[model samples]
Each structure stands twice: as C-alpha cells, then as structure tokens.
Target: MPSVFSALPGAVLDDSGLLHLGSPLVEQRRLAAGEAIAPLGDRAVIAVPGEDRLSWLDSLTSQALTRLDPGVGTELLVLDPQGHVEHAASVVDDGETAWLITDRGDAEGLLAWLRKMRFRLRVDPRAADDEFAVVGGTRSALARVVPATPAGRPLVWIDPWPDVSPGGYGYAAVDPHPGADRDWAEAIVTRDEERRIADAAAAGDLVLAGLTAVDALRVAAWRPRWTTDVDERALPHELDWMRTAVHLDKGCYRGQETVAKVHNLGHPPRRLVALQLDGSDSVLPVHGAAVRVGDESVGTVTSAALHYEEGPIALAIVRRSVAVDAVLTVDTSDGVISAAQEVVVPPDAGRTANIPRMPRLSRRASAQ
Candidate 1:
C-alpha cells in the first residue's frame, strides 16, 4: 500500500515503500523547529488487549513494562535463547490496551509468536496496523496536524533514547548527548487522520518530512533501529541499546541469563561506533558496507547518512578488539572513505560482578 505521505507533491518514496521529502536540509530544519512530521510507513501496530496484557508482556520481553502508566511510553525487545535480539517494539498503553509499534516486516512474525504464547492467558494479541498509522515528529509538530481524541489527548509514544532509564545503563561517554535535544515522538493516528494530516501538509497548512530525514536525525542521535541496524547475531550491548531498551534488574525472561552473564562476566564481542566520514569524496556508503582497518575487514556499516548539521556520518559495528583511536575506512562503490571512530560502547563495557574471593590455604600448613 502506498504511504499516506505519497499524496504530498515532490514526495519520493523509497524502496521500502515509504515516503521521503527529497531534501534532507530543509526537512532537518523543519524537524528542529517542530514544524515537520513523517509518515512512519516502516512501522506497524499491534494491539494487546485483556486484563493480563501488562503482566504477560512484562514476563516476556526485556523491558519492565508491567507498571507502564496509562499513555506512558516504553519499549521492549524479544531476545532469542542465545541472547540475540529477535524483535523490538515501542510500547504504550491507553487505559485498556497495550499498543506495540514495530517494524512492518516483523509484525506478522511477532503477532504469531504472541498468539502462540496466549495459552490460558487473558491477553488477546492481534495486528492493528490497518487501523492505525504512525506519524513521527516532535510532540508539537504532531499536535499541529493530528486531531486529539475525544478525551482531548493524542496518542503519542515518547522515545526514550540515550537516557539511562530505571534499571538501564548509559554507555555513551558524553553528557547532554545530541539525542537529549531530539524531542522525537510517534503518534498513532487513525487512517483517516493520516490522510487528513497528509492533505494539510500538501496544502501547505503544515510541514512534512520523509523517512530519510528521520533516518538522518536518528543516526545523529546514535539510536539503534531494527530495520537497518540489527542482524542475526546482534546483541543489545553491542549497540549500546541498554540505555533505553534493556533493564538490567528486570526479572527473568527469555535471554535474561545471557544478558546477566555478558554484563557481569564477559564483554560484548562487538561494539558500536559512530564514524565521522571524511567528506572530501561525495559518496555515501550504503548499509552493510564493509569497514576496514589497514586492509583487514573489521566491521560493517549499519547505517550512513549525510546530516544537515554534521556532514557525512555513519554507525558501524566493529570487533570489540578494534582500537578506539583507529582510523578506519568504509568501502563504498565510489571508493574507500576515511572514517574516524567515535566510541559508543567501549571495549571494556560490562558490570563488575560481586564474587568474594576464597582465602588461600598455605602449603606449609597443609604439610603440618
């Protein structure tokens, strides 16, 4: 299905069948001014309804969501038995239903899994993508276009990135991170509301942005997304996702043992890094581009974007052994572009487990 944003003039939809406004700089400025909104075609909705929805979800995912307040936002990650991320969702609950916003490609599989887990539980899981369209922007931008519900509140899921939420950890070195200034939120609008919002933007009554603009801003924020950033072997630690997604003290769930073991005993085998690409050459490395150091492949680019403020930048996952000060290069079809590493997750990032050392017995005493 065509995205609602497609109705706007000069909107260029991307291969994922999503909309892009064709100009990053203009869109970025609009976003900063809270005058821009993007149709999140890549995102879908899942409705979990029933008396046990919150508790059941709490027992199943990485985040502690049982106490999620009404209309409050949170996120969840489903990890495999091996501690690899399987699915991720942005979560919000309206008094009666838990709304899960996830990647469109993962919605079906996620819904199927939820259904299988519904045995004897009071939760009813079903896909609600057709009913709701996700529109992302700052809270103010959404208010300008989307109408409020009968209760006078528009449904919005606030993004909790780069912050150390309860039971979470911040791995970034710098304070007042760029994400702190990014007032990113996604509002769930009805299909008619989406069309109305698009029509308003097209008629110049409101400003509109595309997915590329959102991607560029997200890259700058060091936000780890599921579509481009995740792979079969990806772990939350590598992407520094624990800042918002993982709760270290959360009760046992699938992959909890590995999460605890890795945090306390082992460092993640790979670490995520932000790359300042040398902009001498006008080439942007596509996703999955190889990252190399001294002719050896050490990592792969998960995402790359030409920011409105920052020039060419990228996020890459490299072997944890890679030096923080290493001058790397990204292999693009145009040529190799020099990249300077900015650490997201440090090589030694992990918890210090409390284990009392046993007192040693002297050999002389044993002989006596």
Candidate 2:
C-alpha cells in the first residue's frame, strides 16, 4: 500500500489489494465531477533512459513512437508472437527519459524483457517503484495538483480510448461513443508530493477516491484494461483496442503478420461485451464468474462494478458465435442472475476496408 492512502478515512481495499473510499457513491460523484484523485496502487512505473530509448521502443511495440515528442501522451502494447496482447502501458516521454505506467504485476516482467533485448542498445530499462507512485485523475483535475517526476516534467499519460488515434482504426459502429469523454491521466508523483496530497485530503482540502469508483466509470465507458479484461486467449481486436494501441501501417514487429492477417482476412475468435447484470439481489458477481446461455457455458466475466448511475455493470469476453440477442446468466456465489448483453466488439469484427484505387492507363495505350 502507498503511504499516502493511509490518510484516507474509512477506506476499504478491493480485490486488487488497493485502497478505495468506503462510500462508493460519494466517490463516484466526486470522480464524475473531476474533483477526486485516486491512488493508483495497482500501477507501477518503468524508466527507459539513454539516447536510443524512443527508437528502440518504436521498433518493438504496436504503436509508431519513433518520433514521439516530449511530454506527449501515447500508449503501446507488447504483443505475443501470435498477436495476443502480452502487456500494455500508458507512456509519456520527458526530454530525457521515457516513462511507462503499467500494471504493477507486469512491471518486473516488462523490465526483464526490455533488458534481454538491449544487448548493444543505448537503452537502460529499470523499475522505479521505490522512487515514484502513480496517481490517476482527469487531465483537467490533475492540472490543479502538480506531481513531480524524475525527469522534472509533470509526467502524465493521457488516455486516448474510444477514439481512432493517428495510424489506428475504429471497428465499433456507434455515434456519440460512451468513452469519448474519458480524460483519464496518470501522473508520476514523488513520495513527498504524494504525502502532501494525502495531507491535504486528510485536512479537507482535497477529495479522495478509490479504485472502485475508477473501475466503475471505466466499465460504463466500455474501456478495456490489461489486467482484468485479458486472458491467455485474448486478442487486441476482441477488445476494440485497435482504436488506440495499434498502428495498422507501422513497420514489422513481432506479431505483425498475425495482426495483419486477422484484420485483412480473419475474425477474432472472441469478442468483448458490456453486460447489465440483474441488480435484484444487489450482489455484484466476482471476477472470473461464469457466464452461460441456458445450460451451456458461453463466457467469463472479467470485471464487475456498481456504477453510480448504471447500477450493476460488467465487462465479459464471450465467443464471437454467441448471439448478440442472447439473454445470458452469470453464475455467482449467491446465485445465478440474468445478464443483458450490449455489443462492444461485434461478431463480424475484422473486415478489411475496400480502398478504391486510381485507374492507370495501359502501356500500349500510353505509347500510342
């Protein structure tokens, strides 16, 4: 646990072992209004230094980041050889160092992999967990409380969810997307600054929120996270992650062939969906709860939350063959409850666009 969260009153920890406000409703309201900040206990930071840091990362990840400008917010994914998401991170580079904000559980492994691949490069990858803590809020909200970074920049990674970033693609066919207004940002804060913020919150100068509030909002926005929503069989397309994490035309890297093939000629085996769980019992199903269509098991719930406005909501990954209209049931310890499916990544997800080509005159006609 981060020392800063110790100052919070009536804080309850979640399954991720992170502290959150006991009053979820109040926290949710504060968060929605951009008046709260949450200690991102599940997140950690990785520092990449030396001259070739940016170019080396660009050569390895899913995003095109070779020319990334200082203080720019972008994200990238380390993909498996089969194009499955191995790891994902929110990134921002100060003039001298590139900071990666990743799930805490992934930081050590990601650091080791980067070290293995840096045989002769100028990149030095290291975990900075001891020196930095991650705090999350909306960009506008975070602007009011400045955090200090090792590189002296206000190190913030702005989320670009629910939109088609440059060199990315959008597969969901919807206007006024739910996540269009997700202004989430994670700031790397020094321990002293964290304590100062905590003291302010403790003294009634600032409001504090918990992970429950954050996750609930993320569910409502149909945002996919690396830790909860991913399994061994997960594909980027299933989560509609191509909207930001993938660059379709970037130079070859690991899994590029599989990513290209699936986009152009194949469909992902599974798809992500948002579910409105039956709230009659007021019980939220735990993560990994089984989702079934009648007697047959169809999918598994990745994350479940009680939103301020949406009641009980969840994100589930089900087979692409599952009918969109199916009324599913989630098996919880309390009992089975009905699940109404809302399409996120639809069944026919990987169709390639037919780009029109310009007509070229024949050589014989040109000669004539």
Candidate 3:
C-alpha cells in the first residue's frame, strides 16, 4: 500500500497514445453527433416559466444563479444553518429554464425546500427528466464539435464532455419552432455524439472519473464536497469554497448571517491542510488515523489517495493552532507516515487572514 503513491517524473505526453475504453472506470459510452453523455449525480431539471425563476432559485443557495447563462454553468452550495454545506449543484440555465445537477439523493430535498416557499409565484422548480450529456478533455468523437482548450494543466472532465465554458462561457439551446415551449429550461444531453466525446475523454489518460474519484479529487484540491466537507457543525468560510459558492455582493439569504460573522471576525475551530506523507511507502493511512505532533494529537486524515501523479497525499482537518509548516507523524498500520501541512481551510476561513500575528487562544493540542 505504501508504494501506491510515488511521484511521476516527466511522464510524456501521448497525443497519439492508444485510447482504451473502460480503463479506470466504466465502459467507454458513446453519444451521437448532436448528443451528450448522461448527467451524473443527483440532478433535477427545473423549468422557470414564470417571471420569478431567477430570484426564487437565487434566494435558496449560496451562489446567485439568476444570471446563469444558457450555455455555461456554475457551482453553488446549499449550506446548513451552522454554515456547513448541505448540497452542491452546478446550475445551467438556457434562456428560459435551468437544470441543477446534484446527487440523486439530494434532488427531492432541494425541490421540496424550494416548493415550501411557493406562495403564489410564477416560477416552478420541477424535476425535468430530459436526457442530458456532456463531453470533456481535449478532442471529441464528434467531428462537428471541437474540444475546448484547457487552462492550467492537461484536462479531464468528470462528466468528460466537450466543455463550452473555459475561463467562463454561457450558451443557450433553442428550438427552431417558434414558441416550442422555449425548450430551453427542460432538457438533458444524451446524444450519441456527446457520448463519443465523453468516451474519448475517458479513454485517454484523461479520466472520466465516477463520483468517487471526482469527490476524492475535489477534497485533494481543497475544494469541499457538500456532504463530505460540510455538515450541521461547519461554517462556510472554513472551507474556503467561496469562489463560486457565495456572492460577495448578494444580500440576505437563509445562512448569510453565519457566513458574514465568520468572514469578518472569528476563529474556525479547525483548519484544513494537505498532508504529503514524507516517506514513499505503500502502507497508506486509514481515514481515522490519529495525526500526532510528537505526543499531542492535533488532527485526523479526512481524505487520502494515491494520486494519479502526486503520490500518496492526504487531506486533514486540524486544530487551528497547529503550525501551517509543522512536521507531524500520522500513525498508520505500517508504522507512521511522516506528514506535513499544505495550506487549506480548517473550515475556518479567517484564521490565516491576519498571518503571523497570533490571536489570543487556548494552549496548543499536541501528542507524540
């Protein structure tokens, strides 16, 4: 197990590499020229027919989605009263309607929550069963649809569909027939072409990972997943997932008070950090292993993975006082994995804002 994560040095780019279907995941699924791979997770398509769709949906989640474009999408988190995240969804609104892709389990809860406030409004958040699809990575099986350029590094979409949004983009799928119910709000992409693109993306070293791999990647990247990173006890700022989860300028919402107080001032009891196991061995630490700083226990490894390229890396939720650059040992079955911190939110967003200057607090928590 300790040998699982060893650094990859100069792994060559294989543009012409053989595309193998069903490699690290499911079989290579194919979609026709004008289609897409099925939408994954708990997704409910919403048709905002009345004048209040945007405002209605916006008032419920962490991000303001009234302006979500026809083609592109953005991620939003529905946080609990304690400010911890509850549900996460990527919303896509064609000119007239919107589709929220979340976990299948979360679909009904979200729908019912919105319906509870339906006091004579024109908008309706219904579960549209339209087949949906997407393509990701560099190229596509659909000759007509070109693969979008990737930013930062080599690409792979969880849905693995051709992404139309790079650095942000919006689109609308309209019907040729006038007043064809505006076909904008209630559709899913499942065309064969879309599938092919998804297939190709998955086939290449580019992985079209299932929810498990995708979730692991999210936590590793320090991006919080709704259920995993959030709960009844967490606060929003602690996760540092603000990029798309919150609107800095938006007014009051259900959990805004908690968000505001945490951001402005306060210490999040915990901090998030990445643990790079010092020694390269196959024995990986289990999820609940105690991370020790000498004799005092300061944290626990929350997520661990033998990265495709980065080796055995773990994400831990630690006490705020634990030094950001502190060296520690994680007790595992294979003796101990020497681990250290890679800056991530401790679920406490503001703790590090006033860096170096110490805050008045309790004595440190340490265990050998």
Candidate 4:
C-alpha cells in the first residue's frame, strides 16, 4: 500500500473563508500507509498544582521529577503495582505546576486510576485540557502569529495567522488559506483536545492522518510508542523509557521497588527490540504474533508496519534470554514472517542482565 506519511496533503481556502485540508478519512477513505492518521497532535498534558506537586508526582512515576527543570520536558512512566506500565507520557513543569502528556486513549482512564490512588496527598491529579496545539511550517507565514497563552501552560492560541488544528473544541486566529479568516478554518475535537498544543507553526492544518502514516513516522524517529515497545508486566528498565518518562532516581512509586531493583543490580525483565521484516509477501506481524527462535516462542510482535522509509519494521517485546543474533519468525494466520532482531540497548544501560543484586540509591540521588 502507498504510504501517506511520504508526502503532505493539500487543502485550499474558499473565497468565503472556509479552509479545506481535505479530510484523509473522508476523501481518501482508507488511510494511506504511514500517514499520521490522527486528527492532529498526540501531545497530551496533565497539570498538577498546590505545594506537593513534585513529591506527589515523584511518588507516582518512574522518573526523578525533582530534578526535571521547569522549561524542559522528560518522558516518564506510571507503573501498575505489578510493574506493568499504567500510562506513558512526557513530564513538563514550570515551577508552579507539573504537566503530563500521555498516550491518547489511555489518558482519561489513567487519570481516573491516579485519582483512585491519591491517598492523603495534597496533590490533585487530572488530565489537563487536550487543547494543546502545534504549528509547523514556514516561519515567514507565522512571523506575525504570536503565542497567546500565559506562562506555565504553553502559549497555545495562535495569533495573526490562521488555520485551526484538527481535533475538538478550540478557536485560533489563523489565515486558513491565502486570505481565509482565522475563525473560518478553526476546528474543535473536544474542549480538551484544543489545549494540548504548545505553540503555533506555519504549516496550517494538515488533514487527519490514518494509523498508517503514524507507524512510518514512528520508525523514522525511533520513537517507541506504547504497547508496541512495552508490556504492562514488563519492567521499565527493559525498554529504556527512562530518558523521557522514568526518572532514574525518583522516589518510590507504585512499581518503584521493581524499577529500583532492576536498575541497581538485577537485569531487566525483557528487552524491546526493533525488527526489519523480510519479504514483500511477508506482511508486518500483528500484535501478539509469536516470535520464534526456531520453534520456541521467545517473544511477540507488539507493533508492525510497512514503513515508507523502511519497507517493513516493527517493535517486539523479546525475552532477555533471547540470543543476540536471534532470527525470529512471526506466526501470523497467513504464514510465518522472518525478521532479524536489532537490539537498541542492553542490561547495562537499562535492560536487565540476570547477574547481580539490587543496588541502593543515595538519598541525594533519590531526590528527583
């Protein structure tokens, strides 16, 4: 199938001021391969205020939130008691409050879960408005478009230029087209969706992409999306999500014991490895397809795609015991698909190597 992520789509503004970024779902029907298919922006934000924000979040996530700077953003994970991830997202703060942007479908449910676990803490938890928006394109077009939100929360509202981002419920001042009115091209998915954007870009509104384009972009960026690279039962160390999400020394969270245990000494549970699938007829493996070393099932394919840049690629959760040169087969209904495993990290960095005991963290080191 042709990949939609390969090229940007087209749209035009009518004389009446309506801008049309041709609906990918409506016009194209089936999404093109690799298209970023979602309406616009997967970026999510959660706000935490009051005095206990840092400690509260530090206890909830796998990262050391205390060290995270106000302006910078880092990825972190919320793990279930069993050590599986409950939610995954970027953690950003601005001194007063902390913002968490997570996977789309899981945000609300995860927020509800966090609320249930809020035992006697001064910190409040909830999904921040999804109203966050992104403006991508030429700088000349957005020169006049100043960000219109207060500090802490990003400057979301786009001024001077036009073209509202897709999703629900937000208005912006945009040029939608050559001379389109700012209001005419505006879109609203839900009230929350509009609040998710940080600043405005000049690209205007691109069409809503299907799942296809998103997969391609994922491979190109080596961005490990949820479920694809992680399993709830798996430890955070296995997948190396610490860069953005897991705070290396954030105090005790729900699964902090396991995270700390895995980080200091014992090897991680499993490793998330990228794959290059072989053959034209061999389709990308579906989630849960058994990956084999000869006949033994060593892992399962969590996410796969026929990428525009890389013909076929996937993310798989494989046992740490699997050999470095392991050649695995994905057992799909159609047939077996062959792929080579390429390990991104090993136990030393984050992946666990079954050899030593859990290491201890110094109080100073655990501050974050």
Candidate 1 vs. true structure, TM-score: 0.92
Q: Candidate 4 has what TM-score?
A: 0.64
Full-model lDDT for every candidate: 0.82, 0.82, 0.49, 0.51
TM-score of each: 0.92, 0.92, 0.64, 0.64
lDDT tens digits, residues 109-222, model 3?
777776777778777776643434332221242223432221211112222111222221111111111111111111244444335544454455223323333333344445
lDDT of 2 by residue, 3-22 (tens): 55654688676545345767
- Expressed as tens digits, the lDDT of each residue in 254-316 for candidate 4 is 887776666665666577766777766346667888889999999888777655435576777
lDDT of 1 by residue, 24-89 (tens): 678977887798887788898898989999999989999998888887888889999988999999
Model 3 spans > 4 angstroms off: 1-50, 128-130, 133-188, 191-220, 278-283, 286-289, 331-335, 346-368
Candidate closer to the true structure by lDDT (higher is better), 1 or 3: 1
Question: For residue 104, what is the lDDT in candidate 2?
Answer: 78
